[model samples]
Target: MRIAHATAATAAAALLTLLGTAPPATATTRPAGPPATTARPPAPIAWGSCPDSTADTRQQCATLAVPLDHADPTGPQLDLAVSRITAARPDQRRGALLIVPGGPGNPGLNGPTNAVRRLPRSVLDRYDLIGFDPRGVGRSSPVDCGLAHDDLSMTTLLPWPAPDGSVTGNLAAARRIADACTRNGGPVLRSISTRNEARDMDRIRQALGERRISAWGVSYGTYAGAVYATMYPDRTDRIVLDSNDDPDPSRVERGWLAAYATGAEDRFPDFAAWAAAPAAGDQRLADTPQQVRDLFLRLAARLDTAPLPWPGANPARLDGNALRAAMLDTLYDDARFPRLARLMLAADGRAELPPAATPPDAAMQNTVAASAATMCNDVRWPRSADGYARAVAADRTAHPLTAGMPVNVMPCAFWPTDPAEPPTRITPDGPSNILMVQNLRDPATPYAGALRLRAALGDRARLVSVDSGGHDAYAAHGNACGDRLVTRFLVDGRRPAHDTLCPAEH
Candidate 1:
C-alpha cells in the first residue's frame, strides 16, 4: 500500500508513550476469558525529543519492548518505537488515537505529527494522537536483506516482467532476493508479520493504560487496523480506515499485489483527463483523454525496445517498466499527474528526462525487506514459475497499462519460511464503531477492494464512498464533505446509519 510516488518521502521511526483513559461503552462483545495477553502492562514512557528535529516540538517519543514472537511472551523482545502529541484540551480528552500507517514497512513514529497538521482541533481536543513503527521498520529493530542496490529499484521490487512478457528473469530475481533475505535477515525480519503487528498494538494500548483505543489506519494500515479491531473488538473505540485493501484472508498480500492491475485501470482515466486538459499546457500529452492513453501505451511499448538515456537513474535509462512504475506512482494523487505526463513526453523524445526520483539506499533496503517479510509471512505463495508465467500472460492482456507486473513473480514466491499463522479473517463480529472513507479510484488500494473490505466488516462499518481519485480520503484529496463526516465521527463518535457518498469537488 506504500507505493512509491514521484517524490515519495522516505520512512523514519522513533518511540513515545502516553497515558490512557478507560474506553467508553460500545456494542462489541468482549470474549469471556482471562485476557489474551498475560504480560503485565509496561511502565509509563519517559517521553522526550523525537529523532527527527523537524517533528512537531510537542511530539514526544519513547520505546516499548514487545516479544519477538507473541506466542512466547517471555521470549526475546524487540524495541517498538512510538510517538505522541497530547490533546490540547485535557478536560475533553477521550483516549489515545493511534495513527496506523500503510506499507507493511511504512514508519508511523511520526504519524502523530503528520496527523496533527491535518486533523481538526475539535478531534485533537478530544484525543491524544499516538503513532508507532511496527517492528522491523525504521528505529524499531530495523532489518535489511543487504540487497544489491540494483534490486532495490521500484521496477525490480515490483515484479515487472521482461519486455517480452517472459517470467524467466522475474523468477530468477525472486529466487535471488529470497535467498539474500534468508541469508541476511535474522529472527527480527522473520518475525515481521501482520498478526504480530496487531499484537504489538495491544501492547502499546496496555503500556498507555488505555482500556480502549481509537485509530485512523491508511492503505495497508487499513488491513492491519481491521485485524486489530476484529481481534480486540472490545478494545477499539472510533475506527477510521482510509483507502482500504481487500481483507481476503486466503490471498492477503497476494490479493493486494494483484489488485494493482485493477487499481491502475481504475485510476488511469483520471490521470488522462488531467493530463489532456487544455490548462496542462507544456505537460499535456494529447488533445483528448483517449489520445493521452494511446500515446502513453505507444510510448511505453516504444521504450520497451529502445530505452531513453536517463542520467543518474538506477539503470540509467527510462524503459517501459520504469515508465509503468512512474505511471502507478503518479496516479496516487492528481497533483502528481504532471510528473507522469512529463515522463511520457521525455520517453516520446519531445522533452529532456527529469531527474531520477530515487530514495535513500538504506531506506529502500529496509522497506523492501520488511514488505517482503510481511507479505510472505502472512501467507504462503505458489512456488511454481510456470504458474506465474501463465498468470502474467493473462494479466498483461487483461490490463495492458500495468503490463502484467501486478501478477508477476515476487520474492514471496520463493520465501525461505512458511507463514507462522493463518491470515486473520475479518468478520462483522465487532463494535459497530468503524468508519471507512475511500476514493473512487485509488491506484494503490482501489475502490473495488474497499468495497470488499466494507462487505467483510458487515454491520460493523459504514462506508463513505468519495467520488474522487487518488489515495487517502479523510482530510486529504480536498473533499470537504468527506473530511467533515470523518472528523465528525472522530470527534463526536457518530457514524452514518448506513453507507453514504461524497460527490467529487468540481
Candidate 2:
C-alpha cells in the first residue's frame, strides 16, 4: 500500500486509544442494553489511570483477553485493545456504536476518536462510541513475516505484471513473500481471519454488556461488519457500512483485488481532471485531460523497456510497474491526485520519488501484516501460475489503466497456511436496522462491489448511494441525504423502506 501511498496509517494500539480531544454533547446519559459479559478474564484484571480524550471521559480504556482462536476460547486468549466514549445526552441516549475500521488491516481505535469529533452533537448525545484493534492487530498478539527491508515496499506487495503481461516476476515475488510469512509469522498469524475478527467483535460486544451494537465501518471493515451482522444478527442495533466491499464469499479478497481494475477505470477520470487543471501547481502531468492518460501509459511502457535509475527508491529504478502502482494508490481521493501527477512528472524527469509514509514503529507494520495476512490467508487463490498468467493477460487487455495489477497474484497465492477456521458467510437474515452508505465511484471499494454487498444483505439492510467517489461516504463523504438517513436511524431508530441514492451535492 505504500509506493501507491495508499495505506491507511501505521498507528499502534496504545497511541491510537491513548488520546482524544472531541467536545462533549449538551446533555448526557450512560447508554444501556445487554447484560454484562460472564466471560472471565484470563488473568487478574488491572485498571490503569487514564484520562478521557473527549468530553465523553466516561470513556474507558481496557484490554479484552480473547482466545487466539474462538474454537479454543479458553485455551490461550490474546489481548484486544478496547476504548469507549459513552453518550453525554441521557434522554436521547440509545446504545453503543462500534467504530469498525477498514483494512483487513486498519486500527479502529483511532476511528472512534475521529468519528467522535465529527459526530453531530445530537448523535453524540445518545450513544457510547467503542473502537478497537481487531485481534492479532495493534496491542493484540501481533503477527509478522520478518520480511526483508526490500520486501516492505508496496510495489512488491501489489502484483503487477511485466510490461508485456508476463507473470514471471510477480510469481517470484509471491512465492518469496509467502515463504517469509510462513516461516516467521508463527501460530498467531494463522488466527487472524475476518471470521475471527467477527468472532472477536461478538466477544467485545459481550464484554461491553450490550445486546446490540451499531457499527460504522469503512473499507475492509465493511466486510467484517457484514460478517458480524450475519453471524450475530440479534446482537446488531443500527449498522452503517461505509465504502463497502464485494460479498462474493466465493472470492472474497480475490474479488476486492480484482475490483481495482474497474475501480481505477472509474476513478481515473477524476484524477485526470485534477492533473489537467491549471491550478494544479507543481503537478505538470499533462495540460490536456486526455494527455494525462496517454502520457502515463507511454511513460509506463518506456520504463518497461528502459527503467530509469533512481537511488534510494525501492528497486532503484523507475519502472512501469512502480508507476502503475503509485497511480492506483493515489487515486483514493481527489486531494491526492497531485501526488501521483508529481510522481509521473518525476518519472518523466528520471528523478526519485519521496518515501511512502509509514507507521513510525515496527509494531505497526507487524500489526498491519497480521491483519492483511488473515484476509489473504483465510481464502484460497489460484495456485496454477498458468491461471494467473491468463488472468493477468486478460486484465491488461481489458483495463489498460491498471495494467493487470487488479487481477494479478498476491502473497495469498503462495501463503502456506489456509484459514484455521472456515470463512464466515453473510446472509440477509439479520436485523433490518442495518444502513449502508457508499460512494458510486470509490476506487478501493467501488460502487459495483457495494451492490454485491447490497444484494447479499437484501431486506436486512438499506442502501444510501452517494453520487460521488472516494471511500467512507457516511460521514467523510456522505452528503445531507445520506448523513440524515444514517443519523435518523441512529438517533430515532428509523430507516428508509427502500434503497436510496444521496446526491453528491446534497
Candidate 3:
C-alpha cells in the first residue's frame, strides 16, 4: 500500500503474526458515489491476547466482524483484524485513538504498534492506540483482482508514461486492467471503496465500546478521517491529520491522484537543492542547484532514448519508466536521497541500482488490487478521454521530471463499476478538536493540497504548516515544534487558536 504505516516494536509483532492471512467469506454492495449503506455493527470483536505475553500487559489483538456491506449488516459479514496497545497508563487514558492509515489500500493492523514509537509520551500515556486493517487489506479479509504478475508492476500500478510520452500504451493498459478486475474480482473486491472503509471504522468504534474516538490520520487516512467526521461528527473527539490532501467533493481520490504533478514539481526542487549541496561526505549530484536540475532532466531524457540493462528486475531492464519509479519512491522520505543519487550515478555510468526491491508475491498483488479497487470504486474519474489528454499534456510540458505520469491514466479510466455513495464533503461543522500539521514543500502531499483541506474543514481544524519538505511532518519529521503542537492537542485536547506556521530549520 502507498500509505505509510506506522513502524514500532508493537507493529513488528503484529506484522509477524499476520504472516499468513485470508479473505472474508461474505460480501454485498454499496451504491456508487454515496454514503455507505448502513449495516449492523460487526458482531462483538473477538479480543485476543498479544502473543508476546511477556511484553507490556496492555497490548492485545482481536477480530471485528463488520458487514461486508454496510447496506446489509446481517446479510454478509467480514472479519476486521484489530490490535490495540493500551496507553502506558490507563488512569491517564482519555479514550481510544484510531490510527487511520493513508493508502486506500494501506492496512492499519500494524499501525497501533508502529504509531506508538513516534507518538509523544504524553499522548501515549493518555490514549489507547487502536489500529485495524480496513476491509480488504492485510489480515482483515484480503481481496485480489486475480491479476497476473505483469499487471502488478510499479509502472502499471502508477500509470506512468511509455518511454516517449505516448498514451497508446497507457490507454491499452488501463482498459486491460479494468477489464481484468471486473472479470476476476469478487463482491468483496468490488466493495473495497473508501466509503465502506469509513463505515467499517465506525463499526470499529462501536465494537470497541467507545462513544467517541480520537484519531491520528495521515495522507489518505486524512481523507478517511475527514469522511468519518463528516458522517459521524458526534462520535469524533480529538482528530489529528498529517500531510493533508484536498477535499474536492466533485473529485475526491481523482483530485488527489491528479495533484501529484504539482506535488512532484514542488518537491523536486528540494531534491535538487540536496543533490546540489556541497560534496559533504558521499552526497553526489552537482555542486550547484541549477546544475543538479539540468543533470537529472538530461539523464531522464537520455534514459528515455536509451535505457540501461539490469537483471532480476521486472521488465528486465532499467529504463526511463524505471527511473521515474525510483524518483517517486525516493520522494516519500529524505533518507532515500541516496537512492536517487545512486540512480543518477548509475545513469551516468557511475553505479548500478542496489538490489531491486522484491517483487510482490500473490498477497502483495492482491493488496495492490484491493488498493486500486478502493480508489476507482470510491469515486468516478473524469469520463472524457480529453480530460486526461489535456491534463497529461499540460503536466508533461510543466513537469518533465514526472513525465505527466502524475496526471496520466489508470484503472480509474476503465473502472467497471460506479461509486457506491455520494463522495463525502468535508465540512467545518465537525468536532472542534482537529489539529492538522503539514510541511510547505512536501514532495508527495504538498502544502497547497493541505490548504485545500484546511479550507474544507474551516472551523473544525487548525493548521500547523511547517516550512519543510517530506511526505509526512508530524512525529516522523523531527520538527519538535510541530511534534509538540500535535502532542498538546492529542493529549490535552488543546488546539491552536488559529492556523500557524512553523519556520523551517536548516
Root-mean-square deviation (CA) per prediction: 6.7, 8.6, 5.1
Go through the candidates in order and give each one's C-alpha lDDT: 0.82, 0.70, 0.73
Candidate 3 deviant stretches above 4 angstroms: 5-44, 50-58
lDDT ranking from best to worst?
Answer: 1, 3, 2
How much is 164 displaced in model 2, in angstroms?
Answer: 2.8
In candidate 3 the C-alpha lDDT for residue 152 amounts to: 61
Query: Taking the tens digit of each residue's C-alpha lDDT, what string does model 3 give over 1-506?
Result: 23542232111111110001111222234344334455544456666775444434556788888777676666878888888988888889899999998776666776777777677788888888998888878778887666667766666667777765677777776777777777777777877766788888888888888989888888888888888888788999999998887888887766776676777778887888888877424666788877877888888888878987767666667778777777766666777777778888888887767666534456455566666777777666655567777778888889887888777777676775566566777888866878999988775577888898898888988999988887878988698788889888887778889899888775
Summarize candidate 2's per-residue lDDT along 363-458 as a digit string, tens digits.
Answer: 445644665575565566666779888888888989998888777767776665454445556777866878888888887778898898898888
Q: What is the per-residue lDDT of model 1 for residues 171-284, given as tens digits with 9 covering 90 to 100?
A: 777788888888888999878878789889989998898999999998888999999998889999999999898999889788888888998899999989888898899998
Reference-based TM-score of each model: 0.94, 0.87, 0.91
Assess candidate 3 and give its TM-score to the true structure.
Answer: 0.91
Residue 428's lDDT within candidate 3 is: 86
Q: How many backbone clashes are present in model 2?
A: 10
Query: On a 0 to 1 TM-score scale, where does candidate 1 land against the true structure?
Result: 0.94
Compare the candidates by lDDT and give the number of the best one: 1
